[model samples]
Target: MRSGKQADFAYQAVYRYMIDLINEVSPDVRVKLPSLRHLAERLNVSISTVQYAYSLLEKEGRVYSVAKSGYYALPVSAPASYCTDADLLERLYAGTRRPGMQVLSADEPAQLLSLDASLLQLERELLRRHPLQLQPYSQPCGIWELRTALAARYTQSATRCWQADDVYVGADLRGVLEILIEVLGLKGAAVLVESPCDWLILRLLRDAGVRVIESPCDESGKLDLMQLEHLLRTESVHLALFSSTASLPPQERPHAARLLEQQGCWLLENDIHGELVFDPSTHFLRDLVNPGRLLVFSTFEKFIGPEAPYGYLLSRHLSAPLQRQFLLRAFRLSPIRQRAIARLYQNGRLDQHLRALRTLLKEQAILMDGYLQRYLGARLSYSMPQAGATFWLCSTQTVDMRRVFEHLLARQVVIAPGELFSVSGLYPQHLRLSHVFNGNHSLDRVMEALAEALKYGRIG
Candidate 1:
């Protein structure tokens, strides 16, 4: 307890020191904070304490964080476009002033806003830059331009030796998984997955007759690493499907990354949310983990919604037979869409949008988290999703989330109950609330409904 107090004092001291240093810098100046470990050693405080202080500064808009990079000083008015806690809260509360405003809000947190308009904008840009050459037909491995663009993406941050054919661009998440199973002959193979996984991934493997083992999470919302270690040591597990960092608390990701690297299981990295992270310094296990045993894939749908729905699969170990199997089994995306995306990738317009989107995601997550605390208080439990637009929340077993779900559903708000996320109906007391708004409503209004749901336990 005394040491805890000491850590707190140290945290406050570090925070003050940071503010002082930041205040000294001019608006036009740019500076990088010492790395977390470096700052920890310098200040003689724990690394966790330094990390906490940095998070506080980021939330306050004094500093900017970059994933797989480092934190930097923010310019004055850096967060001008970001809605503040007060303004966002006011908007949410204003929505509650209306009659019958508690409709359920189903959280498709990963989807982008304005699908058709955005795609049309991309098409216009493509026409402006390149001659219109939309092919009538394309290859099974997808159009070369897009595949090559995706291959170039894989090499940008981490040096994973990837070539054009190494990427297969087509299909949704399930479709790609089916092709992987067929290509790798994973039928009846023992594959390890973390429990409380995305229902789609879990159900896909189980339904396919693959021997699926669910390694449970500990209270910290991280893999019960001991169990994972045991499974790796004892079980005949050929692959470990770590769905995404969104499934676990953010702070524990480094540990998970380390485990995946050392555990020796063939790694399947689903990096759908990799680009949507708040922390610019953030690095997904897909990039951090050893790439030799790595197979990576994600859909453009994760970024842009189902309007285009272009997706790609990348792997260096794509053998000749496997390549042939992929070519036959997988279909290519539309040529025009592929060409437009390839142009965006090459021109850096798409990358700029993604970077802005990441900032928006982080800002919204923090604001809505504040609302959650104010509305539900300790009655609800959750961690801010490391990389997406929704908060993965839990409540006590006594609180029937289904009743809340029903209550919200009656009002036409379609929130995703946690049970829907798992095949076996785990997280009955859990639910997902999205921070992204499509102009129909806002999060503050959603918080009001959730608070009301808690107040009347028998609403169903």
Candidate 2:
């Protein structure tokens, strides 16, 4: 009904209004926009004007239309300044790759390059016994056969003499921790956590409403016993969660354990990476503390493949309560997976796999450390881990870690910033690099990119 000039002016006005509305609302992706008629009425424009505006937005990839539904807003690509550390972490984990992108951010072990002949044989055996081994539902605690085998392995290793009853298998370490957090009534209680601890666990404690107190450790990752003692004496600390083997070197572990035991606070030891240690005798942490005061949990997902997602907790005191919580939570693990793992352990295949994995991890870690030294040298400082695959790295005083993180991210080499690990945005000059996921083939390229990024500061 209008002239072309009038229509164009009307559409432009409607477009400007829509842009202002989008800026005001900041809608999420797939969020429905106002209906065409509604938008036209609000803008005091013709329906054609609104349609024209929507068409322009769609062409610009700012909106999408669904059949029988109204237009929906596409996720706005905000400027990097608006992105938070958590957002950057999520992008890294989502594996957003650009051309020439080399990801160094993953914490998982590298995919097995080739099939192990022994593992293949085990797989064939598993397939042959598939139907016979299948069960309707897993036991509330877990498959008893797996628990018994794990108990025997623990006893043989001299870690602790755990009976099958004391070992309760769960979906994963996180799930086990959740159950423990609820059952132990950790809500609103003061919980002690190590500085630069596991970020995921720190988030878990916060979400559970626990007052998290950081117990700062020394350069060697050993808890300061005097400070910890002072905290224990002053504050009503409920529990202290830490990595016994991974964080504390062997010689320091017994003393640390003794200190923890004397404090009388409940201890939760994370041994998820204990099995991958190059030297088992010096890296073990089970025998130091009394089981009465400590509850230890470890995951097979790190050693065995992620496909076999199960973790076990050893605690005579809390096993019954954990089991009750598991029942209430309906946290049923897969019997088939449990049976497969138990078969691997029973036939010694698991031990062979572990030995091979440890060797591979050690090689990868050495390669990564060498690359770091070659690339960054004095600009970046780090202590090589004794047991785990991750290196805790810090930037020198001259280097800005935030700028370094931005540079590496731009280069498509994603590394976890140290800010993600702390409760109070501490350790801005730090990074955590895991060499386990990326193989040696990518290491050279990653180092080259890292060196370039560091040298150039921030690149387009």
Candidate 3:
């Protein structure tokens, strides 16, 4: 009976009601939507209003129309995760295990950066007395015991109350990502990635057949959010993957996340260094977005220990049954190791370790940044190390990075070329210097080699 703009409003209200009804039904239901005439009669609205509502719901994939039959509700199901070439995965394991013979080439903390030996000894003694046993998989989402511990840690944060069902622990960042990709239907889906992103992510996207549109990063070293916004508007990217914290300048992150959400895109947050950020402004992205739309990947190795057995993934929307299936299919739980580790973290020891490490790293970053500026002069400045061990170098375009890398290698000094992280592999002039240099010896060796290399036109 409604007409004019009021009629449009009536149509929208009816459409939302129908969607709610469809969503409330069990996944087993076919949800044969009522015919337009029937719906109009039942709701006491015009056939045009019913038709418009149906059209809108169908467009959103909440329902579908058969050629001759009426529309039916679509199943609330996720997409399958598919990857190619286990060989690449085999290579990744091989590479990760070797731990870069050249000490500074890796991003992990200095071996000395761990908790003081005294604390480790104390932890070991405590574990020895407790001697735990492996138990049946606890809830498959993760061990509930660990979730309870984690929830307690974040209890004071701005986030809503977190439950055991909201957490999922996986083997590592990649494992967590794989599970998300599989359940989210990102395989063969379009994705927007930073040009010089984590190489492993690129590999994962490639294997999954996801088309990647690269965003150019600026010299201040943040991903260009404008480009990202443009792409999301024009392209069909369903996901945007980013390191929640990186050696580069803090991302124009909220804007990027907003753009993605506006375009109905999902965000995959690789918070590998999430716990390490000393700056308050560069908070974790998971803290910014709706948990249902964000999948956060975090590892404790950055703060506690690298070999820690468990990694935590936080997501709010994943159903319990899907999480259980993922746990059984992709990984087997090791309860004894997880519980033992959780005990150390729960007793305030982990907080102490993280605080101490943050202090040490912050001081080291200042020292390294100042040293790099003084020695390399105007053309070289350390990337904004908001927090984390990798010191990015914003080198002049004139520098010959290959020669500098080779010269440093000859001196037994190893650093990652900035190109290693680039999507197109086109950035040869930039470098990623490691702050994990063992005292003055390694730092001095790198400085001397770099000075000589610059003189010989080996690098600018």
Candidate 4:
């Protein structure tokens, strides 16, 4: 990378570090950010580079300057959206008038993310050494070497006591989830999911004969704890899967984890976005919760492409029966693929790519946020996520999003509609826009089409 790109990377690194620091404490407690010279020296970058980062953060309202001491982190004082679950649940699904409209499909494959050039190059080099050997069927969960690497990563800084024996691997995220559902006998179990949860997850639960209850979350993607506690107390929920994604591990995260544990509910940490956090040395929920009661599943596909075979399951309490069932049904990853991935861990390339990816994501967020503010600011409502490639949005007006989606589809603009995220199709106007803002898609064209769709979608 050239000096310009390096400077941009340095700026984002400092920006994300400040974000992590701000989120680490309660909003009420004031926290100061490192000085420009101090941060630049620590990061080994020029002081001017840090100055540019601090200025941009102030522009974005992420920090404030006192003119004397230095900058301080800004805490999230209020949620961006405040709609209640009951209110939104009362809204019907936004059915399209042109029910057969040939608009875009919400389900777009991970092209920029999936079929990336860098990841492909890395794979090609690894495959030359590891080759395409068919995996042996000895280790049902995974080979010991790969699992050991994952355990070491999970046990970063000696804060965690993860063991290779506690690790399990699967071909993909969906397959791993399927195994958990079957092994747990969740055919008719009651589960509590966050309102506006990922639509695909909701569909999977529905298919598994799971009775899911919803608790609405705010714009920051945090659910109402009182409602969650009530449901856990009354519903006897088998498991609770929700996102606690932030730049750094929020201190408040433990409260929710502890609540579920106190209720004797199994907690599944959806570490998809969690793993992609900008700060490389952030904490994880595993430190707060008992491992026996938690099952953490995450995919390596984010780092490598989607075809890069491996998703893992980590739990300290892997029973013999569950292990037996896993061996009987789970797909044993190819030996070569396991070795290649393990090599990624051993060489530290994985960590390098992660930092670069996080910086790139933050860069993408700023680009997308600028355009969204310029074009669809009034038409749509959203909060720039602290991490991840996707943006969760809700329409300002209650319109038929299904028709709006179709319109955007006709323009070759793919976006996830609100109905997919809710159990009752409550968020008729909510939608998720992904992958478009990362310089992969034409920003001007996508925004033009999106604005037009929302215009036609405005109905009482």
Candidate 5:
């Protein structure tokens, strides 16, 4: 007796009920469903509602109907096997032997800037000025002074408008990303990541149960907008996580941002190496994307060396909710470290350190590139270092990357294989080398080992 509109709702409800009943029954076993009239009478709905519900189940393959007989349940599909590539990479990295190893694998900066007497003195003075900060736990969003300083710095440097409340501090970029993922409710959602991205982040997304769609990039590390647009048009991607400055140059970012925004996708820009820009007029995503749809992340660990533990996230859309969730989860960063970093920024010491670090890294990159080209010749190809300390190298089809990696590992020279960066295991003939971690003299040894590996297929 229900009306047409009410019958639609009744059918949907009955559809769910029938699905539950079908699931409870044994697979491949025929369960005779009640007739349309009988179901309508039992559920106190019209016969059309019952028929609509049964038709839905039939369409979904959850049940099938014979010409004259009743409907029967279908067997549910089994779950797919889990991929262990990330776990394998994790174990391989942990088992890496570091004793007397000329490590060219880490993305850490080459030289740590020596703190001058004035900077050391200032740190002591700040600690004395605020002894209470060292006594108890700090705020979950981190020390306000540091956040304010960071906001001011971003506004001044990038010409992006920001407030202190827009910043959230965390232990590191990974921890902050985890929190961001949770706050944005991205678990099990489709996320588009640039192919050959940071390996750790790829693993994180996989572990979070999200459907990861890898968008391929060009030789220069820039994302292919055409392919990205194709995916956006085809897939239900919720977020696009990518590096802010690496791979793609400044000019291309705005166009890419426009494409993403048009498709209503959120952008998570990881600007970890934004401070080491070789170009003076480089533009960041903050200047391109709508702040309401963007989340920018950066860390001192890349610029100030890996010893620096502090990192910050800036997002006008998610900051308030992120802070609430951060506090609710009882996450706290070290107050002392926060104050120390703030002091560096407050006194312009961080800028001074950055100038020196950039010069050193640029010099080292040139040296490493020269050595690589000189030693390996036509066997390997790599692009010049632009922003970050790492170089992405592609080997010729004749060379086997696995053999080269094993050869280097045997010589106590650990190098990151290109396969680790790809989810589909596409880059079997590529490698990633970090110039900042190894000195010029040690790099000479790396070249020697690589040349030997190329010639003899082993390093002994």
Candidate 6:
């Protein structure tokens, strides 16, 4: 080890040199470096003082180090400076505060602050039973038992049965889409997307270099399959993605899926809204599953709770070896969180919670419809879902969605803008109102605020 005196001298010299170099190369300004040899000789320092300063420059990434060559200045361009949206998106992810203008910008559930206690307790119990390893990565294939449990849940279908090995854990649907786009070689490839599809998916796929072909949705809320077929015949399509029957009426899904398959395109189904409870009589997925043609995506966050740690992906035709490889390389981490999720399912809490949630959502949907009809008159038109945690409200051209959003936010009311759900920025002048309020009190307040917001909305 170097003597304390030598270490101090080296540290001082290196710090000064780095500061000078940074200032000189930075576009904003310039600064001076101390005379290396002069300072070294003046202080009875060795020639190594100057050499040490130079070496530290390369070591700290301030300069480039080369074999058999001296250091050179680093190219001033940082990775963030070159990449698109890296800074803005990073800031968005880091930002925790809500927007000051209005409550509608985010997709946060209204009762999250209060009802999270139960979820927290459940998570605590899970941790108590099976400890989590925070540092190591999760099992590449996700929690095996959880996958098995999920697979079993859908086993009634003979043609589309799955095993625990099929589920892949991701942060969210965006995370899964990223991997899918990369693995499917979809960069620069044409993608057939619904015109009013989920905005997040459209934006993410576009950012991934996938060209989108937007097809209008029919009155039934299913993809206009005729337009899609024409596009497939006329232009090359790498993939066709859409939300499943949960968003659209159950009667429309199978017909749409059959039409989609005739185009010879790969299908990607995002079933994030599926967990909101389905009627036992409705055979929504009866004929929609064709493993050779479909890949399904779903999340536990909406049904289990927004903070649920896992997302599930299913592909019918993807080979086992490739699937295994994807899991091994992608996960290679711990499966504790997924296992916890499985245990929740095993304890039957998921089903019980979903039952209560559906009941609340259905009640709220009715309440929302009644309020809009009675208070707003004919100014708003809402297309009520037969099942789901949310409903959409349409507004006239005279009504500015943004202004109304601001007005409601000031009154401590939050809702989602119509543009948030639109695929190509063609908002239908609407708002997506959630009915997931955990208690009766907040739900009533939300309806009151919404009615009041609409009154002033026409002129706001």
Once fitted onto the true fold, the runs of candidate 4 whose alpha carbons sit more than 4 angstroms away are: 1-137, 156-159, 247-249, 436-441
lDDT of 2 at 441: 43
Encode model 1's per-residue lDDT on 155-238: one tens digit a residue: 855475678978886544555776777776777998887765665566567667788777766434577656777887788888
Residues 1-460 of candidate 4: C-alpha lDDT, one tens digit per residue = 1143133245567767766766675644556788977987787765544655665555334565543577765354422122233432111111111133221222222333443454445445655554444324467787888899988877754545788988888655655777788877889998887677765477668878999988787766666666777888899798887664652236666777778788888877777666566565666665677667878887776556543535688877755755786676545455555666777788887777667677777777778788899989898878776766777888888788877865675665656677768778678778877642334456787788889999988896
Residue 31 lDDT (model 1)? 70
After superposition, the stretches of candidate 1 with alpha carbons farther than 4 Å from their true spots are 1-118, 122-133, 156-159, 218-220, 244-264, 330-332, 442-445, 455-460
Compared with the true structure, model 3 gives a TM-score of 0.69
| Candidate 3 lDDT score at position 406 | 53
Prediction 1 global C-alpha lDDT: 0.64
Model 6 scores worst on lDDT over the 10 consecutive residues at 89-98
TM-score of each: 0.69, 0.75, 0.69, 0.71, 0.75, 0.67
Descending-lDDT candidate ranking: 5, 2, 4, 1, 3, 6
Residue pairs in clash, model 3:
81-182, 195-423
TM-score of 5: 0.75
lDDT of 6 by residue, 1-460 (tens): 1243233234355557554665455442222334545645554544334444543443233443222333334223222122123222221211212222122233322233222345556556655665543223445556567778888876666777776666665644444666777778788998877656665577667767788887766444555545666887788887777665544456656666676566677878776666654452445443474567777787666566533524567754554643655553453322434555776778887777767766666676677677667766576666666556566667653566665665675665556667656556566477676655444245456656766666677653
Q: Once model 3 is optimally superposed onto the true structure by TM-score, how far is the C-alpha of residue 137 displaced, in angstroms?
A: 5.4
Clashes of each: 17, 0, 2, 3, 0, 9
Name the top lDDT candidate: 5
Looking at model 2, the pairs that clash are none
Looking at candidate 1, the ten consecutive residues that score lowest on lDDT are 88-97
RMSD of 4: 19.4
Q: Residue 208 in candidate 4 has what lDDT?
A: 85
How does each model score on lDDT?
0.64, 0.66, 0.61, 0.65, 0.68, 0.56
Superposition error at 122 for model 1 (Å) = 4.1
